[model samples]
Target chain A: MKTLIKNAVCLIILLTAVIVNGSGQEYVKLERSRNLQLNNTSAGQEISINVTDEYNYLRIKVEGQFTMGSLLIELIDPSGNISRNFTIEAGGVNTSDIRADRAGAVSGQMQKAFRNPAEGYWQVRITPRKATGSLRIYSLQIYNPRTDLIELEQIEKDTDEHIG
Target chain B: MNISVRAPISKKSIAALVPFLLVSVSTSLAQHKITVDIETDTTIWAPVAYLSLIPDFNYLNTISYNHIIEQSGISKEGLYEFSTEYLPEEEHLYRVHFSKKGDPPASLILGGRDHNHFFLFAERNSNISVTVKSGNRFINDLIFQGYSPNKALQGINTMLEALDSIDQNGNIVNREYAIEAIYEDIKTYADTCSFPLPSLYALYNINYAKDYDNNPAFYRRYLHKWRSQKSLYFREFRSSIRGEIKPSWLIVIIAGSVMLSIILTMYLYSRLKKKNNKNPLSELTIQERKVFNLLKQGKSNKEIAEECSVSVSTIKSHVNSIYSKLDVRSRRDILDIEY
Candidate 1:
């Protein structure tokens, strides 16, 4: 009877640890992952990835300097579902889809369910319909339910291979 | 022998023949005096007559006769002094009689000769003539004709003509009665004539201006006064014309248009206000309100599912239902509702 109880306690602790570890995974961060430098003449550009889990979440922070026109950010999920598609404009401190006639910085976030979107491949597409001057994106991040250990290890190995 | 018989009857025969011849001669030449003479300074003339016998003393004793004879005056001792006054001159009639005691009581008509008797006569054979001086016969004739502007103007014209004739010729040759007649005509015309404004203005301006020539002082003063008076007259005439109020068709049309516009504006405003007051949101159900409130609060499908203890798929169905009820699509439309 004593052995059974001790075993039961050990099993409960292990299960609790697994649940806590799964639930508390670190959010995925993409820090200037795409070395994109948009100038006055650059066209539309896109960055995308396939998210396997339906319960995963995504958070994107876009920072850029654009002169004239607006920057459109669109999220296209795997199941052909669109979510949190919006346009960020220049020249104002607040997040506005429409800006006045001047050059300035813009930053905003968009979140959505990963299960279904209006398009395949979890995507972030930036379109500058009338961008003038230089447009440089400083940061962009995507949040998911998966743990960061595997992704960080994979990024380190790719960097070492590129160096060799 | 014949001569001796004739001498014997001579005294008686002579006596009878002398008386017979004297009686016949005296009867043939017998005469009586019945003369009448009008004694007045006024030039009014009329016929005079005295009746010696009454045809019926009781029925016609107080006889009243309207003598409208043509001539009037007196005659005496075979000399006739007829009134020189003309037919249309002063002609008046009078009733006369023997008013004295112990005299023959007979009615007489005296004065202006008309259509009746012309002379006074007594029952006894008498020699008589009537003599009358001229009176104001011209004025009397005009008055008897009645007051008329045309007749009065004619009289004035006649007097002016006479004056012109007298001025041209240095003669008292025209009868005194004619001079007197003209004077009387002028007086009567002056009394009856009423001058109109146009004629009076012309006369006043002409006569008033004639007094001064070299120095325009009088004219200046008179012009100022006359201008004021003329302006006053025109103002009075204008007021008289304007004071006459008559209804105009334009007045009725304007009044009716104002009234109709007011009524139409009030009716349309009332209808619009009534329609706006009856909102469709008042018919919304509790479930619909909950969904709508959450939508307005900007909750995602997962947040709404957790709050309502339902699956995310169930929340999607509720969102669709809310959209149909609110008649809107997309999350951006939630803020556009009036309520």
Candidate 2:
């Protein structure tokens, strides 16, 4: 009986260990534009972050000051697939309840499922709405949870912005 | 004591029922019609203009329809088009667009002048003129026609300015009164006129003045009176405005959450199952892994075979399996894999 319990505990621990390593996350910083005041015109800013690790699940979030849905974010994965996209809309967060003051909390997650991601260039493109306002701390963040034992948190990448 | 009742059928009884049904159907079909005079100086600008009568009263993201002057433009996703040709005269019949009889009201915009640039309430038998002055008037109101836009664009502009307008001491004024006043103004038009555009003018006002958004009494009692006024021009927008307002959002949120939960549960379960069943690392055997490590380190097949005390052919076979697991081709491709 003691041996049976011991074997069960060992099996549980092994399963837990594999599960812990199976779900690993990496954060990628895409763009950083601080304290910007935009007018009655639109501007687009883009950046590329190299995700050296392969992942199955991908999520995107924005930390910004141009209101909830004023900024449009489009993410292109390394394999040239548009992973996540959101734009200025009429009702769902875009054309209403925008403050021109301090920055707010991180946006809700915009998630996607990848068949199998490549380890190459992942692009984040942003299109601020054609509005006149003041803003602070506009940036994009990516959280990728992988299924492999690869250590994504260890790989560090920084890149320049691409404007359109 | 209660009495049970049954009536026998007759031609007279059936004939009486016919008038009642006909009255119901005719009342439903007797929709409001408005003649519009849109005088565009075609000599001033290009003959092309875009027109859209999008439904604002919809909670679900229903695709709306529009038309182009030249009819040569391509349709984009979510926005569709109807075949159109300019009547050559500025005076045209601005079709009255409404939902089914006893349905939610819809708004209309006209511009021989410009594509959906002016807000003209699609009222029953409303006669109005919208003549754009010198420059382009990209607004949806009668302000540019005969008077200055200040007072004419009241429903559209007043609500916008009221939202963020500050007081003398630099404080944001409570916009309740401002919003209430606009509704009161729209109510004046809604009461005096039986047209669809007037109701839509009031409807569009509620978009900016959100406090008055969901009123079942108003939709059921007032909008239900004008169902027969639906036109093909605004057919898509007409069908999309459905059900009670807040419940629509609740249903959408619940449905969305349930779908996401299912997807996430499946995704995570698949990942766990793949890890257990595949044992991904075991795809390459002990010998193949050693060969893989050597190949990653830039070693030739001959050198790897010599180091492993095996023939070159054996090393080649191991290398092929390793390459297959890693989804790569050739020795150069497998060199320096960071993942």
Candidate 3:
């Protein structure tokens, strides 16, 4: 019985060590959305959005003068691939949601996500229609369904511990 | 009849006597004397007229006129109509005057006398037309000669003085011509006078050194004495100018400093890296430490083998195991590790 308890204590210590090391690996937080202003007068103004280690869902919102031109958003990955294409026409100053995984395989598409590609480097391209006007984007949100479930479970556990 | 004849004869005789007496009385004559007186007048000759020659400047003197007489010669009154053939072929100035007293000391007047064949000498050429007249009559052509060098120099000096006066009064219309004349005078003086080259060089150097900064080589070549003591002269020249630095020396100093800094930085970096790589975890094991300590204190591997009572291969195996456990790849790695 003593040997069993000792073995159990050792196993617990090893598991604790493994857990501590595993959790020690850093986790990064990304802002849910960002606003970008693209005035058509200037060219090569790059807007980079990071989508690594997060759920693939993306939502873009735009508000500006709309004409016959189109707004183009390209999803890029680690291998320099255009994994998805999102197009919105004039008067389409609204939110558009997409899942990057379901997008078809194409040349120059990002294959797998990266942990840290580079600081401020883009995994996506957001290009507005070239016209004589200013474009104001209100928000871009990357939503993960798994993050909601995890937050819900945490809240439940905290409530149970508090009641007990 | 006889008586009548006697009376007639007597009467005839008486009548004849009367006729004879009348013939004798008829021979009478008359004589008268005639006398005549005559008067005459003579003209006295006057002196010949002459024109006096005057020099432009004092360096020249007037000379006598050698007049050539024509076929008529000079008139008794010394006044005659001059013919073209009586004019002198060569031109000159003559101090000619009229003289009725036959020669030199007679009273002189401005009357021009021309000869047909004599040459006259004068100081300068005449520009005015000389029409010799006693009252309103014209004379022959007059000739004039030019001044000699001495006289020319005097004339030129007077002209220069006049030019100077004009310049002071601000009346120089053609300044370039005046400058050219001045330069020609300087060149003439320089060519005629013997001046030392060194002195001339120094004078010009002082005059132009400030504005001659662009062509140092030209000055240097012409003024070789200045370059004879090159170092001293260069030092003086450098001090005269502002902020003169030798580019070659600056380049050497900068390159040397940069190379030295790079080498020193690399040396320090390599030393720190060597110190960091010498950890016991990377170079030593526990068994290796024990064996090394025993070997350091003079224990043989065979004695170790005998004490452990193992074969030599087993001892070798233990040694190999010690080497592997020490995490050392070479003996040098072990030796290089600090205690």
Candidate that scores best on DockQ = 2
Runs of candidate 2 exceeding 4 Å displacement: A1-164, B1-67, B71-129, B132-171, B208-214, B232-241, B245-339
* Top TM-score model: 2
Q: lDDT at A71 for candidate 2?
A: 52
Report every candidate's CA lDDT.
Answer: 0.42, 0.43, 0.37
DockQ per model, Cα: 0.00, 0.01, 0.00
Clashes of each: 33, 17, 14
TM-score against native, each model = 0.20, 0.28, 0.17
For candidate 2, the docking band is incorrect
User: Quick one: RMSD of model 3?
Assistant: 61.3
Superposed on all Cα atoms, the candidates' RMSDs to the truth, in angstroms, are 66.4, 32.7, 61.3
TM-score of chain B of each: 0.23, 0.32, 0.20
Docking class for model 3 is incorrect
TM-score of 3: 0.17
lDDT of each residue in B208-252, candidate 2, tens digit only: 223235554655455466676564322432443443344577788
Please tell me what DockQ candidate 3 reaches: 0.00
- Per-residue lDDT tens digits for candidate 2, residues A1-164, read 99999999999999998876655333333444444555557587766655444333232333232323355556676656454453333113111122212222112113222222345777776666553444333233334444222332132112212321
